[model samples]
Target: MRDLEAGLVDAATGHAIVATDADGVVVVFSRGAEILLGYPCDEVLGSHVARLFDEAELGSVLAAGDLDTDAPARREWTLRGRDGVPVPAEVVVTRRPGVGGVPAGHLFVATDLTERRQAEQLQDELIGKLGHDLRSPLTSVLGYAQLLDDDTLTDEQRGYVNAIERNGRRLLHLINELQTGTGRSRSAWRGRRIRRR
Candidate 1:
């Protein structure tokens, strides 16, 4: 039996805890486990952890040599919940050290990353907006500089103009990449719509 008070304290810290046998049968499933995996103890206990996995991504996940074997294993895997929704989860599995410092049953902890996806989307939007706002001035500066010729300008003026053109062109390159995420020459630009959003 689990110590409910201690388990609750652990749950408050955000790690979902479980214990399983070597063959993968779940033994102890805590509330944190319930929230993270989205299957209650009654349903998950005595069940294989593999049941929580998406069958398709499993082979590659195992082949990656990514399992932690240090009395406990730690890994990240995209797991499917009872609702059949795929979620990114961080997992840690450790064996309880026994008399000879050998493992008893496996102990597992999982953390769900629902908030992380939101943060990444917000970051991408900010970068895309910053890139879009800087594009117009850079285009104008490059346009004016390209119109100048060496015969009409002093050496220092030519050098300054060249620097301006180079920086503007670089800025344009970065903005295009941010907007479309692909490199396309001006000839290709006419037919393709940039994926700015």
Candidate 2:
């Protein structure tokens, strides 16, 4: 039984697990918490768990009732590392129960969000670059196609120009949707609409 208990404790230590009493005094700090926060377990074990967060954000979290709920609640928090720098963290808080069905404490599980945020930002930048590079050349193609809609063209030539104009409009619509996330592209431009310009 002791070995099984120790194994469970070891598993918890792999995550940034923290347990605090009802009044918010820290009761347990895990090894993963120490590594992530850069704080020694001794420095935080008996202190208030508030040391992990900025006062203003902590107040907001308290007001949001994220710390105590019948079920686990997850929210983003900027926790203070031992170096005094803010760490972007996503924390899940749940109630810890004691023997005899009494309320024991709160348990917190935290994960760093820095890498995920960075990846999302990078994706946005790449999308912007693709939109710019692609649309510039497409604009020139569209401008020249519009110039070809003159009456001097033969019937076969006019048919070719109509095809070009229709395809170009569809491409532009697709590009617009890509950047703006609007729904599906509208139907291809009508012949009269193309001839008007």
The number of the candidate with the highest TM-score is 2
lDDT, candidate 2, 3-122, per-residue tens: 785467557754688889978899878778888899998999889999998889999878987666668888888889999988888998898887886768898889888787788677
Clashing pairs for model 1 are 68-73, 71-95, 72-93, 72-94, 73-93
| TM-score to native of every candidate shown | 0.70, 0.77
TM-score of candidate 2 against the unseen true structure: 0.77
lDDT score, candidate 2: 0.80
Off by over 4 Å in 1: 1-5, 8-10, 59-68, 71-73, 98-102, 129-133, 173-197
Give lDDT tens digits, candidate 1, residues 1-197: 34775557455547677777767687777777777767877999888877877776667756864443564566776778789898787777676555676555667677887787778677668767877678777777788899984688999999888888877776687677756657754334444553422
